[model samples]
Target: MQSSSKLFPVALISAELRGDLTEDVYLLKPNNSPDPSVELALTRLGRAGHDGARGVPVVLLHGSFANRRVWYTTGGQGLGAWLARAGFDVWLAEMRGHGLSPRNRLYRDNRVADYARYDLPAIAAFVGEQCAAPAHWLGHAQGGLVLAAALGGGYLAAAQLASLTLCGSQISRLHGVLELPPLIWAARLLLRRREQVVAGWVGPGEGYEEEPAGMVRENLRWFGRFGEGRQDWAAGLVEVTIPVLALAGAADRSAPPAACRQLLERFGSPLREYLCLGRAEGFAEDYGRAAMLLGGNAHNEVWPLLEYWLRHQRLPERR
Candidate 1:
């Protein structure tokens, strides 16, 4: 399959630290398919009126069961826009199934691991090719896992990435949470009626839809099971050495503070930082009202802090 392109008006925001900001939509071709069509969807947000010498490029990766839009709607403050205004090029990625990508009808082949093998590596390589300078990687939830796996596998070259940041993510199998009895029932029902579940989850939207057959089956194969606690691929996180920042939500039942800490602890980086935001942080309160981090409320509260860290690293002499 050949790649296709479409443009959309992504929400943009300006930040206090940088000059101007703007966001754009993008579609990336998949690398592995025999006929490999556009395998990824993304949004590119850039800082206005700044040369590449001003700062490093930043790539934002969204979590599981979510597309790039989640970051924008949730409280990201259009993180891409803010980062761009802050003088950093920003890119937000949508893994195959969640948003603006093609839909998958096959259930037997879906598994979450495909993200690491296909999506994450593809995004990293794409950024390396597009950006004039090394970029920093920011990921939330499963997005973090994909990054870790990519780094572990050597898909993310050190020369191409300045650092890695994870929000509401963990590397320990013990950190996972499932909705329990209800989730179990839901999974069983989904197994029997995958199409209905896919349709319900992927409501009509400008850039949101179902994933492809092989990719969806692969995601389900790994992440399909439901229960109180389940884990896979957490062991790969320990291999990353890039500077890391791990952020968590105090009220997030899915990825609790304790688990997030446990996950961050596995990272051996000397520059690692960890933060946890309370409900009072109002990260999600403004979700859907304005573009925050990427469209995510959690990411919005965390973006400024991340920008501060990135800025400091980029301009150590200022400190």
Candidate 2:
């Protein structure tokens, strides 16, 4: 069995007000095992007095091979900073393998699902505990996939969220066919020569600077066994009726236009809304289509649309 904990230097921004933002690095340690020594430097943001609201909070999760910085560069200060200016607290999460998140030790047996289990759940719990109100959940790409897994596994319930938004998410394995074959080949080659695969992905000598060895191993494992488990989880998309919004970029190769359509069709929420940028919306003129899909550009393009939806949303009575 393995346990994970958050470790990092904490800096206080305000002494009297007790207002601060802390950088948390995480590590997964197996029972009785020597500490792995490497850790993922997970970054999170906290703000107070946002948007006329005293403490509304929103948690943003970044995608694969990316750190939370994408939200700043591509997602633009317009989104996160705007929310903060509007009186909402905002937090961003960097997954284990990317960005500031590093590993606890040099080990070669980690998998992506390890993140699905450890990193994601921990972040969700932390948000639930720390926020003044149930936070709004937003995920992009692989982040979206992780959130879907958490929701399907009963890790996120309506009580834990103000709303759930999936941007460029792949809700069904039916859409993963594009990468299945190559992923299988990669797994086979890794099985035959694990060191070579790890070296290629994790690189050489730059051990401490490289991603967690365990995360590299785990990603391989998840990609190899792809659709074997969780048909029920895939089917459970229909049950996510909590004022959901599904956004897609018209030009996304990973989660193509067809896949986006299928996801919206499968989801059973009456209040659900779908926005396809670069199609009939003429969103391509303002923002590059690719940028729209990769970040929150699509969401920003349709901010007015979301606002209307939000106004109509009948939030459950708070407990």
Evaluated with lDDT, which candidate comes out highest?
1
Give the per-residue lDDT of model 2 (tens digit) for 73-176: 43345344444444456666665445555443433444444555455665656566555678777777667777766665554565677776766766443223
In every candidate, how many clashes are there? Answer: 44, 24
Off by over 4 Å in 2: 1-53, 74-78, 106-112, 171-183, 186-231, 264-268, 285-290, 293-319
Model 1's TM-score against the true structure: 0.68
Q: Which prediction has the highest TM-score against the true structure?
A: 1
lDDT of candidate 2?
0.51
Whole-model lDDT per candidate: 0.56, 0.51
lDDT of 1 by residue, 148-187 (tens): 6566555555556788777776544321233344554444
For candidate 1, the per-residue lDDT at 37 reads 42
Candidate 1: segments with Cα more than 4 A from true spot: 1-22, 48-54, 73-77, 104-108, 171-193, 196-233, 279-301, 313-319
